[model samples]
Structure formats: structure tokens, C-alpha cells
Target: MSIKPENINLNKIFIKYLNEKQYSKLQLHYEKLGKTEKQLPAIIFYYACAITLNPSSNIKNLKHAHNLFEMLYVNNRHDLQLLCNMIELSFRTQEFKVVLPYVEEAYKINQSDERLLLGLSKIHLYLANLKESIKYYKILFKINPKSKINRDEFLTSLNYASGITQEYYLSECKNYLKLLETNKDLEDYNFNFKNLKNNKIKIGFLSSDFKTHPVSFFLKGLLLNFNKDKFEISLISNLHKSHYDNITDELKLLTKNWININSLSDSEATNLLRSFELDILIDLCGFFRGNRFQVISNRAAKIQACWLGYNNTTGIKNMDYLIADHNLIKKEEEKLYSEKVLFLPKIWNAMTPSNILPEIQKNNSIFTYASFNNFHKISDDTIDVWSKILNNSNSQIILKNPMPSSIVGEELKLNLLKKFIARGVEKKKILFINRKKDFQDHLGLYNNVDVALDTFPYPGVTTTFDAVLMGVPVLTMKGHNLNSRCGESININLQMQNFIAENKDDYFNKALSLQKEKNILQNFGKNLREKVLKSSLFDTKDFTKSFEKIIQKIISK
Candidate 1:
């Protein structure tokens, strides 16, 4: 049935916004349009209400909006984008659950709309549906083969919460490099390195992860080592002051200038960076949430590059270079980036001093297996591997995480434990921990654990660093993707290849062998602390030199 042209007039609705009463009358009239025309009018009415309704009117209006969307039964592309916009706005207003049905519908619609795919992927990740999230990410990657933006976004989001699609991670990395070669803008990324001598190069570091974040953990060492007299360090913080923590406090003291860019408009942030006259702006939080990727698009900084917080190169054209080491990024693998590759001597990650307690060897009665990595990284394959380890060693697994603290945490813990038990790991053997104020006590907790298990597809980076620092050896599986291969990187650098496993049998064999050689394990753990301290991994001074060299080289070009 064709509706009258008067039905969808957007201008007629705008005229009704002269006053509150008129707006209400217009909204009611829009709702009536939904009753007669099943789909199009319903979609239009919801779209209008979603945009026009005030906070006081939002809750009631949102229900009608959602109902309208459901009645529309949208299966087409344009309708899907509109639905995504509706769901995204709902998420902003703490209406997280209300969007799920729409997300489900979106998943069923096309699954190829890059935006829809990513939005739905995020919701699944938020819900801790790791496998489902990976499924959608894989589809998104396949559809946008040339899109570095989609690839980087999918990988970054996957890496942060759960893990990554191992098969896609490496291929995408190579594709990004190929894109970079023809990228003329980044060809002479080394232009201003010689200019480093002309004046102190104004270096700006941008990130939303400046507070109590893993990015901050790795960055602290580099910032502490920067030659403040030679490099003027400016920080573009895309974070609210209310969210500030002790980590931010520490970082604030390290940078030469700190600007809170969260509240500032995009134009405001651009003007502020331009005013600072930044010669080299380093983007630490590449494509991660609240990252201000648009700032790079604006070319606010003269020289922009993506560094260590994220592993893969950002697909953004404006980002000039990606800092990598020889091991993590192979020379043969350089063609997969959107930015020119600048290889460093070793792995880019550097450790810092953060009140870490010394390792205590305890003769706890129970043989404990501990994995401190996040719960999302705990995939079905990972759980199966750990259950095998437990069965082989006759040991209990203690899975400790900072999440699952409150009542919600308890429920999540129970659900996860049940999943593990279903896979053959005894329910009694598994342990879950909620938030702990003094994470320094984690070292003491490690005393109860004889071994620390690593998750694959996305192995632990900082977690491995910490486990080693605390003298707990991590048993890791090497795989094809960069996400899974980091354990091999750690093993190679630490001179502990024996600690790395190639396959399921090798992983189980390594765990069993380590258990038998308690003395060797103890000695290795003690020496791991010494090894990290002596190795390039902990050499902040050298790392700072290497980092500055890259910056100087870029600036001189």
C-alpha cells in the first residue's frame, strides 16, 4: 500500500518544534503514521523521535522508537544504517540492553555493512561473547580487504577485550604495508630528523589510555627516558578529568605539556595542537576508543606516527610511520602497512618499576595453575588447553581476573566456571578473583601457583612481562598471527625457547616437564627477573635512544 506523499515530510515535522506542546503533538502525529504504514513510516518516526526527544522525554520515547524499529522488520542496507545509528545513540544514554535485538537483526540482515558489523562486534565483545565477536570480525575483515581502517579497528577492539582472529591478523598486517608503499605522503617520513638540531622537536603524544592502562604501563619507561631538554613532549589527552587516576598523575609529571582534549571539539583540538607547533606527533592510542583518529585526519601535527600501544599499523593515510622491531615485523612482511615501516633493534615493549614485589617460592600444599590474563582471552580452545594441562598434571587451575568483582562479577564467574567444567576441568579446581586494590600482592598470590598459563589467538603481552618480572614462567603456544606469536618473541628474547610450545602436545609436554623440574623452574624464575633486568627488554635508556633516533630521522626528512 503506497502512503500519501504528505506522510514522510520531514519539514512539516520541523515546523512543529516551535514549542514543547507543539513538539509533543508532532511526535504523537508521527506515531500515528507508524500504525498505517508498516515499515517506512515506523523507521521515520523512530528516527525523528531519537533525534528530537529531550532527556525527560527520552526513556518513554525510546521504547516507542525501538518498537517502531521492530515493527519495520528492516532487512535492507539503508534501513540497517539507520538502525545502527539508533542503537549507537541508545548505547550512549546507558540503554545498552535495548539495542541488542537491533544488533541481532543487523547481524542477520547483511553482516557485510562494515559499520554494522563493527557495531555488533563491539556489543558482543561487551557482553563477553568472544567467539561471536571473532565471527563478525572475520566477516568484516573479508569484506573490507583494502580498508586499513576497518582492519585496524577490528584488530584493536579484538585485542583489547577478548582476543583476535588469528588467520586474518597477519594477512591484514601485510595488506596495510602494501598500501603504505604507494602512499606518497609517508614516502619521506624521515624529512625533519635533521631539523631536530634546529630546535627542540615539539613531540606530541595522543591517547585516551593515559590512566591506569596497559599503554601507559609500556609508555612510562619511554617518557621517563626522553631527553626533556632536546624534545619538547606535549600530550593530547582525550580523557575526562573525572576519570583521572594515579597513572594519569604520574604521566602528567612526565610530559612537558598536557592538554585535556576530551571536552574540546575536534576543531578545538586541532587549533590547540597547531598552536603548540608540534613537529612530530605520536599517536599512542591508534584507532582505540576515544583516540581522536579524526585529529590525524585533520593533519593537526606536522609529523604523525603510530607507535606501540597497538601492534598492527593504523590504516589511516595521515599516520606517517609505524615503529616496529625486526622480530615482531619481518622485512618480508613490510608490504602490509599503510605507513612506512621504521624497524627498531628489539621488541618495542619496555618494562618499568611499579612497586612490584619480589618472587616468593612457597610450598603451598596444592599444585596451583594461575592465568592472570583477562577473561575474554579465555577462549574455548584456551579452556580446553588448560583443562588438558590440569588433567595431565593433576593440578587445580586458579583463574584470577580484576573483573567479576560485584554481584555481576560473581554471576559472570559462575557462568565461566560452568563452561570450564563442561570442558572437563573440575569446577572445584577453578578459581575466579574480582578487583583487588593492592595488585602488588599479586606476587604473593603467584607463590601459591606453581605455573602460569598463557592464552592463545591473543596471548598476554604485559601479562607475560609481569609474570616474568614476578619470576612466574608463562607456558605459551606459538601460532601464525602476531597476536599469538608474541609469546615466542618473549621466549626468544629471554633466552627461554624451551618455555615455548609449538602445538597442543608440545604445550602439554612443556607444562608437564616444567612441573617435574621444580628446582629448574625455581632457578629459571629467579633468573628470569635477572634476565629481564639485564636484557634489552628492560633497558629504558637504550630504548629511549632508539625511539629518539626514529623521531629524529623522521623530523630530518
Candidate 2:
């Protein structure tokens, strides 16, 4: 039956009760509407809204909601509001696959809607559809050049693009920075140089990830081994405490000063940092989330450098240096970066090993290749290359799902599985593992892996170190950019250059060759820990000394 004029009143009351969070009233109003074909849209819309408001309330709890949606699907409701609400609910619940059809339908009705464009862009990016993300970001930029989300997302999309050249990426970064500079009142600072007579050199580090992050993992070694008499260290953290605050207490003891600047505005933060009068300020969170570029822009320290948190350039003109090693950044590549290169003498990062080691596998005839890198790094080109390797070898591949607990995470895993299956690889041959809660259990998974295959154009850094520390050899494909060469850098430090491939064909050949030589793999696996411990990769004391020397020389100059 069609909706009567009186039924429209019930719809309005239903919405009002839903907004007021009057579930009892909302149920009364919904019942008042009665079961009619025209009322189905309103029923479904209200049901979705109720579930969103209270997550414990499922759509199944209201039998009419499901039946209404199915009926509406068969016969067009043409209700944009209902579609929008459904999309909103799906997004809120992280049901991205459920949101796609609703988004597509909404987009058709209002192509020029900014919210629709932004939502579509974010959804594609979340789904790891890099090309589609870039497309929508470009459109959003064209429509609204001042959109900060579009600018940030565009840069992130560029980072994930494996085919993009360094020059092109640099150009985009410069243009983005130019826009930001023009929009803000960024004033340059001129600090009077004062040479300390006998006091320690005051150094400050800026980062939002001083807790259980990879940045903290690599940075703790330097902080722990610092020459306290020569340098006084301080930290400006943007986040108070994270679940991964394993080194929090240790860091506080090592640091002379620790400031939590998460609550401060950019201007306020810059002023606070300037008050510290830091001799050297190093930005660990370069272009990552919660980055205080304004503090560096205002010149909070005499010398400023970017390191660790991000792999590429920040494109900020005031930033003095981008710390790297000769391996990660070649002299020729320095021209593309916005900041001057500070080439560390040894490995740029020094990893602290876990005391608990997984028992190395000794009996497996079948060689199992694995990669624990994040899924975003596994681009289409990377998948194609990996498929070729799998096709060439009789070995099966294992991948770790970084966010295995979420719906989006599961979707990403399914997408990867589909891509592998399309490449003539058997579904049973591929395995997707979840991230382990305990760090020891996480490392223990390395026991199952024969060799770790590195993701191209954005290779593993911490994953590589962990694999080698666990006596698993990582095969990395070298690329022109810094993001791709991180694994290679670690390999070079561990003196495993033979595992690094120059190109795709070489990468495949290297894997196949390694699979054939089980004795070499076994020997490498047995002695890998000793090799890493002896190398500069874990030589924290030496790395700290060399790092301090570089800072001293920079200040002296």
C-alpha cells in the first residue's frame, strides 16, 4: 500500500526521536508508521541510524529494517537521504565493501557534492586503490585547491605509487609546500650563534611516536648510548602515551627535558620550543601525522634535520637536512631532496634485538617465502613481480596482515588473495597471517619463514631488521627512491648484498636460486644473528658516536 498523508507525520517524528536518542519514543513512532511499501525507506533509514548511535543495536534486532532494505533494493526507492545514511552507517562501522554501492548511487545523483568526492577519495585510499585515490584527489584539488585533506592525501598517494619517478614526486612536494607557505604566515628566524664554553650541547628531538613505534625502537639505542657529558638530550612529543610505550620510562631518564606538546597550537608549540633554545633540533616525525612543521619553520633550533619517521623529503625550505646513509641516498639523489643530505658514516638506523629468539626451522623441504611489510607497500607492480617469483618457484608465499582484526583489513587480505589467484597461483598456496599481540610471538613467526621477500618501491625497514635478527634472510629488490632502498640499506649493513636484486627479473632469479641452494640458506640462517650483531646495524655505541660527530661538524661549520 502507498503512504497516506498522515504517514509523513510519523516519519518526521521517527527522525526527531532518533536524533533525541529517545529509543523508546523512536520505537513508538516507527510502530505508528505501520507496515507499508512507502514507509520501508524511512524504516530502513531509522534502523541504520539507531544501530549507528548504539553499536550494540544490530539491524537484525529490527526485522523490518532488513526486509525493507531488500524490498527497496528490488524496487527503486530513489531516496538519496536513505542511501546517504546507509553509506554513513557502513563507513562508521568500517564496512567499506557495504558502503561502495551506496556511495556509487549517491555520486550519480550529486556528482558535484564536495562531501561525496571527499568520502569517495578516502574510501578508495583506505581500500588501497591508489589510482582511484589519486584521481579523486586530483579532482578535489581542481575543485578546491585549498583543501588540506586533498593535498596531504595526494602526497601520500604519490608515496605509494611504485612507478612514479623521484623528480616527479619532488616536483609535487615542492608545489604542495609552496601552496602551504603561501597560505600561512611563516616567518623566518635568525638566532644568534653562541658557542658553549664547557656545558653540554643541547639537542632536541621532535616526534609524535616516542613510544612503541618503530621510530622509538631505532631511536632508543642512540638515546641509551648517548655521551651525556658531550650532549644534553630533550624530547618534544606530540602524543602523551601510546599502548606501545615500552621505552617511555627509559627515554624520560635519558632525556634532560621532556615536553608533551600535544595540547599546544602550532604557534604556541613553536614559542615553547624556542624557549628551550635548543642547539640542534631533529624532526623524527617528518610529514607523518602530528608533525609540527611550523616549529621547524619558526627555527626553534640552530640546526634542524629530518630523520627516521618518514623516508622522503618534507619539502620545507627552512628544514636544514634529511639524515640518511650513502646506501639509502646516493650523492646523485641529493639534488631531488629539499634539504641538504647528512650522510651517516654507518647504517642510518641501529635496531635493538629482542632477547627471545624463535627456534630456527631445520626440517622443512618446502621453501616458504614471507613478507611482514604493510599491505599498502604491496603495489600492483609488486604483486605482479611477486606472482612471477611464485610462478617460477615451487614455494608458497605467506603475508602478514598488519590490521587483521578490522573489516577493512580482511578486505585488503581478500583483495591480495584474489590478485594472487588471478595470476594462476593456487588459493591454498597463499596464506595471510594476523599480527601477533605479543612482540615475542610476532618474532616467533619468523621461524616458519624460509626467506622474507621485501615489497618494492616501499620496502621493509623494521621488518627487514626483525627477519635478519631472527635468522631469516630477506630478499629485497633495489629501486631508485629512498622508500624502496630501506631494505637494501639494512642488507648492506648486514653484508647481504647478494640478496638485493637490481630489477624484477633479477629479483625472481635470486629467489629461485636461493630456493635451490638450501645449504646456503641454512648456513646464512644459522650465522645471521652473529653477522648482524657484529655489523653496524646493531652497533649502537659506534652509531651514536658517529651521529654525534656529524652533529658537531655541522654545528662547527
Candidate 3:
């Protein structure tokens, strides 16, 4: 591992430029070295710095960087730092396919590098290699037991793996929670509520997605319909300043108190929340990004509960309850959650309808099945089942691409096409569509679909609402856990029990059965909008009253 004199001189210049933050000079230094002789290490270092400085560099620059790295790599320079830096750049640019080999090579060079191991784990997860992802994650955890980021990511990957038993999921989640609890001390706050004398109950909602998000879509109706005389609502928003939207404007008009806490530290946030003296603090985000679990873990309010953003348990001891309907969480599954289950009467979420309507289906000769869920949810099992449905009937499947603009997105699409082709499905039959920017256009795409197919182990929540609202029937297979049963809950609330499948055979049979009953489907599609409009799913006023009653009961106790 002795360094060459040329390499030593190049490293000295590189370190000097990096310390001085002279990125352009670093590139100039490489150009200078190139004139004298081809300095491979210097060239690779130059590209790495360029990519690091400008992550949004165009494809031409990225291709040049990749070429430089490959040239040195093939020549056996095998610099561990250079390999890791290139892998990180690829990840930053969302070029995940470019990262795999670099990570593998880095692992071979130094198996002890935590950064390389983490990147390898993430790369496998992105490629949908769940077992490999888990293996690398376990190795990383063993190497660094105190890394919060690694622990959280490991729990998330484990949660998404198909066919994981509920017992195993709960055990892993609990272990992760224990790690979090041990690493961070909980904050304590004392408050006096003795001054209460027939005043409105103060309710606070905390979330990062207070605008243009699934939580906002369901939450707006309830906010608009709240009985102002009985409740004073406060929105503790974690939304970044750039993400403000018209929906945020509407929310502001509905509530008098709107506090932006995105810039606040956990201690500062908790102090502000305690100042408001909120009777009930509702955590709309559970385990999702931008979650202030630190504040929640500190007991920011008299009563705190989790809902909407995540289906799984928060595993925080301070979180009092999990808001769900009986249909979503069965009585037998209560032990799986750390929080006490608070069952809503009918639907747990209230829907805010889109003004745009789906165009009516003209011809119903052949069936078109669709799913707009994220690409990660389409596991091997889901593909296998879906392929069977497509193979058995005169059907075509439409899947909305999760990230159509990225290289990783393109790779995922190709992988999916290969899977379908292996299962005897024509490439043309499986249509991968880019997501529309306009919300109305997104809804209209469902018009082209006959019956929407729900993903397994993790079902669609907002997408299901959007599909059915647009007169598209969704067929779902119920699962053993709360995450899997979201579709079933929606179907049950719509009073469409026949659309719920008990098993794989049942799911296929139900889909096949729908293909034959064109008249029934046509009629169902025709009347769906009206049916949903009348159901508890869309009855926000009544839903608000019921929700208010629950809040009042909790406060009284």
C-alpha cells in the first residue's frame, strides 16, 4: 500500500484545494496534471470533487465522471475513498444503478467501512433485493450498534419485506424503540390545567405534510367542519417554507392558530407546545420522515395519539393511542401495537372529494387492471399474483411509475417488464405510466382503468380513495396486519365486501369474476361517486362530531 511520489504530490494538492474550498481550482489542477502526463488518481479525484460540489450536474458531466472512475477502477487503482465518494455521488444524483459495482468493490477493499456497508444495504433495498438488504443491514448494525440512522432504516426495510410475521415485525420494532429510548433521555414538563372553566378544548395537530399531501386531503374536510364553539384547533406545521400551497392557505383560513415549527429544535418545539397548553396533541405522522418523535416522546400535551401518516406502531411509551377503525385493526391484533387502539365508528379517515370526475369508460370488452402505488410495494409475490391474473384473462395491467425521471426509475421499470415477460405477459400489455403533475389529470388516468389492483403486505390508502372516487373499483386481498388491511377497511366502509379477497385464489377469482360481470361493474362504476358521497367516508360533518366526542371523553377522564 506504499504511495507513489506522483500520487503523494496529487493528494497534497487535492487536500489543499478541498481545505480552502477551491473546487474550481481542483478541476484546474487536474487539467494542469493532464497536460504533463495522464495522472489517473488525479483525474478520478477531480471528477469526484466536481460531482460532490454540483449534485445536480447534467448527464454529460455525470457520464464523464463515470468514465473516469471506470478507467481507474479497471486499471486497479482501487482507492477505497474514491470508490466510496463515487458511490455517494451516484446516490445523491439518484443514479442507484451506477452505485452497485462501486459499493461491491469498496466492500472488497475494506469490509470494515461503515459508510460503504450502509450504501450497499441501501443499494440492495433500491433494487428490491430485500434479503441482501437485510443481510447488509444486520452487518452494519453489528458494526455500529449506536447508529440511529442504521437502526431506523433497518426497521423500515424489515417492515416492508413481504411475508414477515406480525410477531417478528413487532419484536424488531420493539428492539429499535429500546435503542432509541436508551440513546435519548426523555424531556419532562410540568403544567397546570386548573384554570379550565368552560372554555373550548384546545386541540393541536402536528405534521410535516400539512399541504398537498394525503394527510391534508383527508384532514381538510374535518378541519372545515369542526364545531368552532366546542374546539379551538391549532396546526403545528413542520412543512418547509418552500412547500407552502393553496391547501395551506385554505387550512390557515379554517384555523386561527398556525405555527410553523420546522426551524425549531426538539426542546424549543416542546416548550412552544407546552405554552399552548393543548388538551390533545394529535401526531399525524408516525415513523415517516420529518417526524418530531423527540417532542412526542417528551409528552407535549395532556393526551397524545398517532394517526393517518403511518399504519404501524410508533413504539413510543408516551404515545397514548392509535386511531383506527375496527375493520382496519381487529380485536385479536391489539397486542401487536404499543398504543391502545381507539376505534372509530365507521371510517377512520374522512375524504375530501376532488372536483374533477373520471371520464366514463366507453368500451368494456377487455379489462384493464391498474395500480398507482409506489414501486417499492410491488414485491415479487405481488408480481407473481398479478401476472397470474393477466395471464388468465384478457387483461392488461397499468402501473404508474414511482419516479419516472430517475435512472433508478427506468431500471425498476425494466426489471418489472422482465418479470412480466417471464410470466408470459407481453411487454405491450404492461403499461408503465409517468405520474401527472396536475391533480385533476392524475384522477382522470383512472378513467382508463377498469379495476384497480391493490398491492399486498402494504396496501394503498390515498390512492384507493382517489380510484374509487373516480368510479374505478379496486380489488384487494386482506392481510394479517393493520398495514395490509387498509384496502379492506376502505372496501368495507364503501359496503363493497364482495371486492375483498381472502386469499390468492380468492383474489384471482374475484378479479376474474369482475371481468365477466361487465354490466354489474358498469353499474357499480356509474353509481360509485354517489355511493361514496353518501357513505361515512365522505360525511365530514358527522365524522367531526364523532371525533369531537371521542376527544371530549378522553379529556374528561
Scanning candidate 3 in windows of ten residues, the lowest lDDT window is: 183-192
Give one digit per residue, the lDDT tens place, for model 3 in 255-278: 979999999987788878877888
lDDT of 2 by residue, 398-492 (tens): 88854446434566677678888898888877888888878888888888888899887888888888888878899998878776688888888
Tell me, by TM-score, which candidate is best.
Answer: 3
Off-target runs (Cα >4 Å) in candidate 3 are 1-17, 20-37, 40-47, 55-78, 105-113, 184-198, 363-365, 402-408
Off by over 4 Å in 1: 1-120, 136-153, 157-198, 355-359, 402-415
True-vs-predicted CA distance for residue 62, candidate 1, Å: 14
Considering every candidate listed, which one attains the maximal lDDT? 3
Preferred candidate (lDDT higher): 2 or 3:
3
Residue 343 error, candidate 1, Å = 2.4
Per-residue alpha-carbon lDDT of candidate 1 for residues 327-386, written as tens digits (9 for 90 to 100): 566666666566788877776768775655655576567677788877767776777778
**Each candidate's TM vs. the true structure?**
0.73, 0.86, 0.89
Candidate 2 ranges beyond 4 A from true positions: 1-92, 108-110, 183-198, 240-244, 403-408
